[model samples]
Target chain A: MIDKEQVHRVAHLARLELQPEEETQFEGQLNSILEYFEQLSELNTEDVAPTTRAIDVSNITRIDQLKSSPNREEILDCAPEREGDFFRVPKIMGEG
Target chain B: MVSIRDLHQQLINKDRSAIEIAQEALQRTKELEPKLRSFLRLTEEHALAQAKQVDAKISAGEDIGLLAGIPIGIKDNMCTQGIPTTCGSKILENFIPPFESTVTGRLAESGAVMVGKTNLDEFAMGSSTENSAYQVTANPWDLDRVPGGSSGGSAAAVAGGQCVVSLGSDTGGSIRQPAGLCGVVGLKPTYGLVSRYGLVAYASSLDQIGPFSRSVEDTAILLGAIAGYDPQDSTSLKVDVPDYTQYLKPDLKGVKVGVITETFGEGLDDEVKGVVETAIAQLKELGAEIQEISCPRFRYGLPTYYIIAPSEASANLARYDGVKYGFRKPDSNNLINMYTQTRAEGFGAEVKRRIMIGTYALSAGYYDAYYLKAQKVRTLIKQDFEAAFESVDVLVCPTSPTTAFKAGEKTDDPLSMYLSDLMTIPVNLAGLPGLSLPCGFDQKGLPIGLQIIGNVLREDQVLHTAYAYEQATQWHEKQPSL
Candidate 1:
């Protein structure tokens, strides 16, 4: 049974800011879903290996060579804020 | 409402110009747009330009591709170069992709004209397009009902005669469910059978791009254009791409069909079950050997998908912070605050809910109980398919539990909406190819789909079986009044 505090904690972890009413609503929704998920406890998967991917292909490496993109300006243009050639963001560190 | 083959023949015979065909499709789309709300953005200029190129090739006496001049809708989740690929979210509402997706890129290379970017549930999250931040795409058969989603617009466009065919990505039944509800042919190819490069990631392990069309033959033609290994997408399967159209035979002789016993009872609507059962009987009459096969772990697919998809989605969508492309909330004091506010303001409710669910499942003290357990259960489900296929060539079931429901019917209950994909989700878990085609209509005149699922990489068999059944039925011949 997840509570509003836990819902808020989950929302925070997901980098989402939920309103007070949304937290309460999600508390009910999440609990019902989680409770429904509890039905999986019936299956005994004690020795079963987890299937991360449906197909088994691995080590897909490409040659590490430097190649310049033709659309560098177009790529940079998609950024919300840019400083010349780089993406601009909020300050990460306090003023010394 | 012509098939791709007929349109292709018309172009070759010079009976219709590519520009004229494109114009007719665009004009029809405009007429249906007010009622269906199927497309997020119509690429009229780009479509006309592509049609002109095809016409130039025709005038030069060069052989054109099968898809040349065929108008098609693309689900906005795929990145189309220079086109706004919104994925039905406010976050990407203005985000124009700089590169093309592998599938759409291949489609364009085949000379298929891009009609527009169709709407979908935000980040392809919900079972219905109600979760779309832009607009809910209405079911073409009935105006008040929803076209099942998150590929609702793609399916609706094909059914409403807005486009001859379209492309949609399926993760947990997005393509098949909407195709079922909209009365069109939709296929979700085996995972890794189609490349995922430039497709905005939802659940990497489960996502697959496929075609939506009015006929199985058209679907086969579309599938052949896009299925192959690409150096860009490492997960793509390295196998010979067969000309899928060759496998479309009129008879199902020597085919062994399995009717999944678990899918018929309980929550399934009686009319849907009856329609699918009749379709199976028709398959048997077409000389298929029918057997009742039990995939016991089938019902567990929903909960397992909820855990696996959201966990991966939480990781995939983490890239949507305010610093990069897409919507950014202004005036944040710190880096973390910006990410929180941007995501909070930019994403719709269902997307946020899924992210939260995924975060909780993968968080500390809960990972072992939720995510790991779900993966282990997923192994059991895959084994169920493996064991069933040893005795059967293909599996048959209802694509969705019910026909299309009213637009706002399942909006308040997320779990109820999730149930819409119950029959289709397990196929994604096992990475199998599944195709949905119209079998019959319910008493309400809503369409019911018969799902034909094939073993991994056995798309030829799935198409063959669907083709046989489709040829024997008149359901595919009927189109919506719109």
Candidate 2:
């Protein structure tokens, strides 16, 4: 049913650290969910192309034009953190 | 007491100033906010200013849009320039957008006044508005029960009489489910009928910006204003945007309405089934032909939807890193921590859960097994509609399994929450249009929504069927006791 290793792997992939409290609950939940998904394994889709979009569209493009977008200041105004013209965030690479 | 048609008359006769109507709506919002919590942010100043501008235009004999002064609640997912487009998530609590979405921009251009941004599930991922990081929008009818989400606030706003209409995004029944729960008219147009330029993506292929209103006519009026081909949304179809309002009063004679026999079976509340069956009988009396249609693939709608929707959600939500817009974390030594901590702290539980599931589904070995497989199953579900529509003009079912439950009733149970949209998700998967209309009430007096499903571009039939049903029933006439 619920695979602890899969749950751990999923947590790692999603970048979420599951506390002990959540792990027990998630183990059962994720397994039940996977069991539901296993139902789809029965469907015959050897010839079907995956329907990525609901409607069919071909050559959906617009003329490339350099239209003036919101200025940099206006764009960055909504950012939670900023430095000069760029958005400032935690130094994601090296220790400061 | 006034439909949009009559309201237009009152406006034309100068019996009501746009400012007067707007102030009335704002006053109602103030009165209802304590109980309903329908709005995340109310744009009273902006709304009144827009109303005065409309009055000025009318006085100057300048042509005004049909909905020029009507106050409408916009679900928070649709970005409004200079307004916080939170999408009911804490991560974007202070994240105001610099640009308005195409749908909102279209409505603004067409003279629809924005009352405020309404609440929704975090990223429109849940059925109950309880998942909203900010607040839960109470159904105007009961005040204790939920207004179905992620468009709960929009539906509650319309149902509560705070606004004449509202805009909502439907991803796996967000619009229709809330509309059903709230006892109002909600339409999720064919996936590409309305542009998705500014509406925050939950499940890209399934998401659509639609209308929530008190009447079918109001829904049509609003849909007409917003529906059009937009080059901004690559997925938006270039197909002709029909004058949807023209189909408001279509001939119902010979209209083939199909009843999904399975939707009335187990899992549906007895009261809801009774209401849907009664609505069908009334539709049959309205000179429309009724037939029993079976869609077997609908049984797997949930599993297929979960896989495909989350897979897309995983890819779509990748933009919200600490480096870009919205919330960012503090100094971190590495990129992985930056991504993980920022997302973990910023996103709410439901969003994190979905992201986790999506990431897992798209991961290396699981990609073909989960995500790719789901897409294949999605086609079979779509084909089910293709075959069923051949014999029917529109498929009919209960919009939800039941009326709105108490707000906290299903919040802890994610599976129960997922099942809330069981009936509505298939239509989205098939890329067909569906509408939820007030058909009847339960024994507890809670409103029930009868769903009308139509083949691709058969919105005309859907609206007309709903209109005929509304015309024959007095259910929609009853409002909240407040």
Candidate 3:
């Protein structure tokens, strides 16, 4: 069974900061779900190929062409923080 | 609610103007909104405007489509230009999509009026609409019970006669489960049968857009309008769109129906089972050759879906990092902190739990044992369907194990909630077309659903069978008195 440390690690990887109570709640929840998933091991699929999609349509490509979007202003307007035409982000470079 | 064909007839025959119909729909929606809480945002002005356009065409002796001026609800997961397309999440609370999803685009082209955006489980994650950050949509049948979700609002809208028809996205039983609970007809068209372009992705492989209506004919009409090839979605099938209504014959003569034995076993509610069994008997009466087919790997759908859907969701939802559109938590000094805090603050508990589960499954050392293993089992599940279809034209089962449960019934126990989609998930996993139509009602007067699953791209067979059963039964004619 996974503990709080492992839950925290997974939460961090998913880019989610869990509250103390949420971490504890998820620990029990995840372990129960994972335990249910253990039933899959009963089937021997050594030679089985994994199915990624219901339909197998492969290598779908379109002609490379430049087409300007008509809603550029509307798209940029959806950003939470924008600087003129670009989206603004928090600092990436840390202080030395 | 009237059928789309009848509404179109009313418009063309000048018995009722499109504006009048739209107003009536909107008025009904307004009246029911307090009790049902189905819609997130109603586009009353836009719907009336679209209806006026259809009215103009009729006055000028111009041809109009079947869906012309029919008020419809859209699950907010699909992008709607200039509309707040929240996936029922706080993250996208203010995100107005600048574009239209292919399905909605097609519906607009067919002259369907956009009445509103419906609520859903946040990011289409939960079985019950309780996960919606906005509101928990109540079942129209029983105001205290949950309209099964994440397409609860869409199903409720259609079933409650708030709209003639509505669209929903099903990753795993999102459309069908709610359709069952709300006593509406819902279809999850074959994956790739309906284009996924502009749908807010939850699980890329599993997510599909479908219709919810009060009758099989309306479902077929809406499916015909939306099902086709599109260059925008690469996964869309490059196939001809058939007139799905042509297959809706009143007889299921010589049709092979398979009763999935695995679905009948443990945990299924006795009332639901009895109702489904009666529906199956009705199918036999319609000249269908019924046989019991065992898909041994069927029950594994829950675990397999939990892994695959979340794993893909983890990747698809990564785009929500504070850099792009959507809610971004402020006051973060660093980029990483911005992302973590944004997600933590924006997402609900269920969404966060899924993200964590997916992260762990796809993370280092667990990929082979979890995600890869689930995918392999998914193949076995597919093969089981393929084998069954070799002998049967369609498979039959209960759409949901039980009818609509009271809200907050399974909220605390996520596993119990996951069991709600047990029978329906395998259909999504196999990429098959599945539909749920009202079969009967339980002791509590809540509706039970009969699921009809078809082979890949064989929606014709599924619709035909459902049409036959629907014609014979009076279940679809009953609506809840609000």
Candidate 1 residue-wise lDDT, B1-482, digit = tens: 69888999999999999999999999999999999999999999999999999999999999999999999999999999999999999999889899999988898888999999999999999888999999989999999999999999999999999999999999999999999999999999999888999999999999999999999999999988999999899899888899999999999989999999999989999999988999999999999999999999999999999999999999999999967699999988778888899999999998988898999999999999999999999999999999999999999999999999998999999999999999999999999999999999999899999999999999999999999999999999998897
Q: Which consecutive 10 residues in model 3 chain B have the weakest lDDT in total?
A: B315-324
Candidate 1: where are CA atoms >4 Å away? A94-96
> Candidate 3, what DockQ?
0.76
User: For each candidate, C-alpha RMSD in Å?
Assistant: 1.1, 1.6, 1.0
Steric overlap count per candidate? 0, 0, 0
Query: What tens-digit string does per-residue lDDT give for candidate 2 at B285-317?
Result: 888898999888897889889888888887888
i-RMSD values for every candidate model: 2.1, 2.2, 1.6
Error of 1 at B414 (Å): 0.5
Q: How well docked is model 1, in DockQ terms?
A: 0.70
Worst 10 residues of 2 chain A by lDDT: A87-96
